[model samples]
Target: MDPSQFSSQPPEAYKSSGKSGMPAAPPPAYQHNPAGYPPSFLNQPVPQGPYTQGPYPGQPAVTVQPAVFVTAAPLANPVPDYLAYSIFTMLCCCLPLGIAALIYSIFTRDANNSGQRELAEKNSKTARTLNHVALGIGLVVIVVIIISQIVIRTAR
Candidate 1:
């Protein structure tokens, strides 16, 4: 195959890259300094492109975006405020409050394992149950006392 096929022009007209305004090689002689001077040629500034100045009119500068660090752990959400309040209310009272709390506890227990919800529900239920029992017993004792008083009064 003819080598002439490789280029647009004839081989006889070939010129060294230097003749075409391209770099030939490094300037041959380096001035050696007894003090061990750093080379000057490498320090020369490379030709800069127009874009290197800064961000373009509408475009952002070419920046390396910070990688978002994601974790295997799931994201957390805040517990609803009303649920927290209800559970608190149940604890302070003694009677029927306990019954209501028990209902809430059972209903929410599974749903609340978000840890916060479960704990609040559990406490509220406990309070309600305590109050409900206390109220029930207290009412019975009062009724018995009233009936005895009426009987004594009638005998007199």
Candidate 2:
């Protein structure tokens, strides 16, 4: 069979002529309507402008407002959290005082994040004080242990 003839023939004709041996049904006919679409959709006018009137009749027209943005100014002298100092004291100095310091440092950070300036400052000061006391006590304890070891060795 010629390829050109095959391309021109309908699919049903090809199938019927093959092993089935059945007659090919007639191809469907195209019926064009004078009116392309329903009158309701085609006759409706498109809305214009940024703001359109409400869907129901006699409703007020909707108005669009521009977006607004607000930003806070950077602080001149921000309170310190002293997190690293608290952590260091907690790990290397005294356990109880260091833990307290660490807690205050966390509080300071939380207050700072919440925009509570006075609370942040207070927490920061407390953390600093706790760290200092813990470090001082650690140093004194270390000195006392060293002196006792030296005296014990000498006595032996």
lDDT of all predictions: 0.51, 0.79
Question: Which residue pairs overlap in candidate 2's backbone?
Answer: none
lDDT of model 2 at position 33 = 33
Q: What TM value does model 2 have?
A: 0.52
For candidate 2, write residues 1-156 as lDDT tens digits: 767766655665455666766776767665443333322233465454445544533567678899998654434566898899898888888989999999999998877766778988999999999999999998999899999999999998
- Specify the highest-lDDT model's number: 2
Against the true structure, what is every candidate's RMSD?
16.0, 8.7
Q: lDDT of candidate 2 vs native?
A: 0.79
Off by over 4 Å in 2: 1-76
Best model per TM-score: 2
For residue 49, model 2's alpha carbon misses the true position, in angstroms, by 21
Task: State every prediction's TM-score relative to the real structure.
Answer: 0.29, 0.52
